[model samples]
Target: MERIELPGFQDLRVQFDYDEDTGRIQYRKLSNKARRASSEAGHVADVGGALYRVVAVEYPSGKSRQVYAHRVIWKLMTAQEPPREIDHINGNTQDNRWANMRDGSGGANSKNRAMPKNNTSGACGVVWDKATGFWVARMGLGGVQRTLGYFENKEDAARAARSERLKNGFTERHGLPKSGLDKPQTLEDTLV
Candidate 1:
């Protein structure tokens, strides 16, 4: 995949201190007047059911743009632009720890997603087919949706879906419950 270039990335590096290990970004000495130096730099954005950290960075040209915090950390840690999609290894979107992230393709990232809240069969790709009176298993591989098969038993369908996912390099953590570290208890806890 091609790397995504960020305008004024160098200036952003100068204005923030990114802790690669902890996945925290703090405002540096040249940060905006409203924020104090060494303070935490972003806000949490809940998209779908996932929480991502986003920061509004002001460039030298005086234009402010919002960027994903995980992408910024990837650039800082790798010293190169990151891929368009960043995947969380543990299926917890809010856990930005360096070890839990990877430069992911759309297919690979989709394979690592948490189970949907609306899932009725209690599995990632197994669903009840009302018309057929059978449990159906499906998978998305390399951007193509493929039907594994239909089964009379729900568990059999779920097993088929899981087997296909594993064969296609899906993580074991995928389809598990989604969770993350506790939110900051106080304003000071948000600081570096």
Candidate 2:
């Protein structure tokens, strides 16, 4: 999804500020601070495995609420609430850096997913075609599967699959190669 700058963050009290360059959000105070000066921002924090700089802000009512540091920064940076799903471009969920965050779609996010736990093929979009006796090259783009082709050599198939993924704007790191299964085995090695 395309990124846009929203304009509702100003509605909230000036208790937090975000630095897009550094991807840091300074929280003026904790939720329990009891309406302290907004000038005193809190330090970076890790809440529930994600980096957060908690802030005490009024939301829904007069009472202040403790919000996620990333969401707070997102609001401050974009002046809007982020989409329901946010993408951490670098694959580091805790890296709430502004450049690392973007409005995310399921298709785009899935394209950045780590290789499946049960992946036997070392390449991203290659699988052995048992019926055809050839390595098949295919790509999944925007939920649509496009067959690249079949090849006798696994390396060639892997190259074809990787190319198809790139042509569709998939990240280079998407479905990164995991094991060494992509390398061709020698006949002698197989005999043992």
TM-score of 2: 0.65
Candidate 1: residue 6 lDDT (0-100) = 60
lDDT of 2: 0.62
How many clashes (backbone N, Cα, C below 3 Å) per candidate?
0, 1
lDDT for each residue of candidate 2 in 1-192, tens digit (9 for 90 to 100): 223333357644356656677665555545555444544344446644445455445654465455555566667776767676677776665567799887766667776655566667766678899999999888877667888999998888877877677677776556663232234444222211
lDDT of each residue in 1-192, candidate 1, tens digit only: 123356556776776787767777877754467666656777888775577887776667777777777877777777777887889876666678899899777677877776667776777788788999998999877667899999998777777887778788887655644432222223122111
**Span of ten consecutive residues with least summed lDDT in model 2:** 183-192
Measured on C-alpha atoms, candidate 1 has an lDDT of 0.71
- On TM-score, the candidate that comes out on top is 1
